[model samples]
Target: MRVPVELDPDVDDEAPTGDTITVYDKRHYVTYLRLLDAKAEGADWKEVAQTVLHRDPVADEFRTRRCWQSHLQRAQWLSREGYRKILEQAVANKL
Candidate 1:
């Protein structure tokens, strides 16, 4: 999937939690993928926060870690469950 160029660099301290995907999830689709990839590769959270989430770990450790953890959790959820919703939407659109 293409990384969305228009995605906002700023991330919320905590990602939204729900059974259904939100507009925030759609907007940060690429961010979620990147976070997943980083996790799989054993990338450090500090580096991931700085590079992927655009947060300064040194400047705000607590907030940065919170954002990373929340986003990573959301990313995993997207991989495990949210993709099904996306597929359903795609199929619905094609019908």
Candidate 2:
């Protein structure tokens, strides 16, 4: 079953991938931060899926779960690898 997700108008809801980097990661910086905060607080994937990803968990449990997990993992990576570069680039652009 394909999960029907209603992406938040303010968020950049690109498909999560196994690739080490993605353009959406840079675009959705604040979304990644929110995901990181949720993970830090030990939030459940179901909650994150519905709230953050706008996924209907009950409609397609597997896809919803996978979506939340993959995006959350990508969010972790964004915090470690990508975010610093974004900050540096922002500072550089200012100079």
Candidate 3:
């Protein structure tokens, strides 16, 4: 597993999209984990946006929602497919 980096409360309006991981993914790994944990606990998107992404849902609902959704989707992608890439890299490093 990757060591946790400093948390960045700042988030983009939209997350990086694509099959492969990107630098944004590496930077926002903690954000992705928080998003996933909140989701599993059935937290509201608005709450997640405000708490995890540090966006004001009421002040900018559209942007906040967009950012939350994109990040959540990316988080799910990481759990499902992106984790394999991380594990592969870890194993390769050990070799």
For candidate 1, which ten residues in a row score worst on lDDT? Answer: 1-10
Model 2 TM-score (2 dp): 0.69
Q: Candidate 2 at residue 7, lDDT? A: 34
TM-score of 1: 0.86
Model 3 worst lDDT window (10 residues): 1-10
How much lDDT does each candidate structure score? 0.87, 0.67, 0.88
Candidate 3 lDDT tens digits, 1-95? 55556486578889998877777788899999999999999999998899999999999999899899999999999999989987887788899
Query: lDDT tens digits, residues 1-95, model 1?
Result: 32343454678888989888677787788889899999999999999999989999999999899999999999999999989998887688789
Estimated TM-score for each candidate: 0.86, 0.69, 0.86
lDDT of 3 at 58: 100
| Model 3: per-residue Cα lDDT at residue 29 | 92
What number of clashing residue pairs does each candidate have, in the order they appear? Answer: 0, 0, 0
Better of 2 and 3 by lDDT: 3
lDDT of 2 by residue, 3-93 (tens): 2232342432344555444455555556666778888999987887788777878998987787777777778876677667667666877
Residue pairs in candidate 1 whose N, alpha carbon or C atoms collide under 3 angstroms:
none
